[model samples]
Target chain A: MDAESTAASKGALVDLDEATCWSLLGPAGIGRLSWTSGGKPFVVPVNYRVSDGRLEVVTAAYSAIARECDDAFVALEADSTDAEHHAGWSVLVQGTAAIDFQHPSSDGPRPWPAGVRRQLLVITPASVTGRRLT
Target chain B: MDAESTAASKGALVDLDEATCWSLLGPAGIGRLSWTSGGKPFVVPVNYRVSDGRLEVVTAAYSAIARECDDAFVALEADSTDAEHHAGWSVLVQGTAAIDFQHPSSDGPRPWPAGVRRQLLVITPASVTGRRLT
Candidate 1:
């Protein structure tokens, strides 16, 4: 079967182009950061911003994300869904995260949780993929 | 410092008890599924329902989720965030996933995308953790 047929056979979920994926991720919003700790996977919701085409999250220094994500490969996922309409799009950004003390952006993401969220987790995407459910 | 002080030092994000975590996950809705494939982490948004205290997702048989998740340890994350209020709660369910062909649920989650989503992925939680940002 051809690629089109293959996609249709599975569910006809459209594979979004790279540009569309970036467009979906351009707005600063809530996203889930997935990483491995102790050889186990963990996912947590975080407030994020797209700065210079990279994902940035402000977190507490003592939080699990700050402790485990630095210098590690992680995946950040953001999506919007309408349960009533049964339509939405999802974008996935997989990349390496590093602690950036000197993020040049003056307007970075401000985490909602109250505390000294001094540490910045910067994720430079290695791959950006997405799908649209229509 | 003491435990309470330690929590305060981090940012005062309240640690939710297991019962509360279950409560947050009780309603069926959109959640992200995270898993490791080829030593790299991947996260995708999925429609899920909690049946008998277990998380269930319906996906295409040929989808990456169906192929990579069976018998593998994974993490399912669900949350509600109010960007304006800056208040939200997130629940994380970490456990093993198995493809269940015999899911007895008569009212399982129906995939929104157009396709034959016959495979049912059931996640039995090993740990349920959550935090509330007030």
Candidate 2:
């Protein structure tokens, strides 16, 4: 509590605007996906790619993500941290998930695992927010 | 698709049992916390510690995690991966979070950001699951 109290008086929270948030998403290909199934929440890491204001990803047709994320509201996050240095930045994208079955995944990030990840999904964000801890 | 098919026929998925799940959690103090806020899912990482089958953490009183995680069902995950080798493992804890105001967060994992993280919380897990991609 001593450290916390002293630190609280000089909070270093920085707000990241929309453009900055998108920029942070630019060089990142892996992120965590949060989604709900039957009213309970779950989170898992996925290989992702973002461009033109949209987040794109693919998963195995029978994987848990493919089964749970169709038409669901989800949040995807990517971050960089240096714990020993006490510095980090995080970006969160909250949106409605839409599965694209027609075109299929052409040229985008692939699944990390050894499998046929045929499920192509896209997220149209309702809001994008980010923050930096300096 | 060619790479996927080859990998699929030789799937490298490995199941991680309860004991292994806890072992992977050892010495790791940071992880992502997933919780639902107003019927939508969200995730943020936090500093966390595990002991005696319980996961303990603290957060700023006014932070989003403190407000949404009390008495709520949440999922916490920690993982390590090597992209070049496609090797990774993840552990997930699903449970009900309880806020302990009387205890007042004494000698536990504290928040990383410089703030008064007074919300002392404990998660009693209902299930612990894990997986390894070799």
Candidate 3:
């Protein structure tokens, strides 16, 4: 069975279609970027913008993300939850990250932390999957 | 330099001590769990509770997390951010995960998704690190 059917069997989660996943990713937002470093997984929250079918995040040149994620396979997870209502939707993007110095748009999403975040890492997605909690 | 000094040099990020990291983890809340599967990384949002100096989360027995994370090294990241102010703090827990059928608590955090989520994954943290955006 595929992911959708597997989630369907759970009864509480409904698999979202690819189109819906992209829609929920929105034009810009916050998400968590995860990657393996030194044989252990690391995750950190980041601000991102969706542009030209890719997700882009700016980071300080010396940040761990910039240092470890360039040319790496990573995952970015974004979601919105109403904990009080016990409802939310999450989208996961599996992708290859590369530092995009060539086409770094001047209007891309800025890093939240106060710093000279001049490096832009663009994630070219390999798969986009999502599920909604009912 | 250590993690604290590395972050200090960035100027915009302040390294949070171990005590502060635990304090921010609080008694219970939401976080993102990340681990490697098939040599690739995956991350998902999860509801969690802190107990006995460890973090616990419930997942469907057949869920991806349950299937892949047992006896594995994983990371859990939780944070609070005010997008408008561009300020917030994030805490990261790097640990080992084990399914705790031996001591499944009756009052542990329940899964947000509707399901027979009876399996409890206990994460005994090896390192608790955090940083705050200035």
**Model 3 docking grade:** acceptable
Best by lDDT: 3
| Shift of residue A82 alpha carbon in model 1, Å | 0.6
Q: Candidates' lDDT values, in order?
A: 0.84, 0.81, 0.87
In candidate 1, residue B96 scores what lDDT? 94
Q: Give the Cα error of residue B44 in candidate 1, in Å.
A: 1.1
Separate DockQ for every predicted complex: 0.43, 0.56, 0.41
lDDT tens string, model 2, A31-117? 888898766778777888885678988887888887888898999988877787667888889999877787455566767777666
Error of 1 at B119 (Å): 1.0
Give lDDT tens digits, candidate 3, residues A33-97.
99999879999989999999999998878889989999999999999988877789999999999
Choose the strongest candidate by TM-score.
Answer: 2
Runs off by more than 4 Å, candidate 1:
A1-12, A104-107, B1-12, B104-107
Model 3: share of true interface contacts reproduced: 0.65
lDDT of 2 by residue, B83-131 (tens): 7876788888889997778765556785767766687778999989988
TM-score of chain A of each: 0.87, 0.89, 0.88
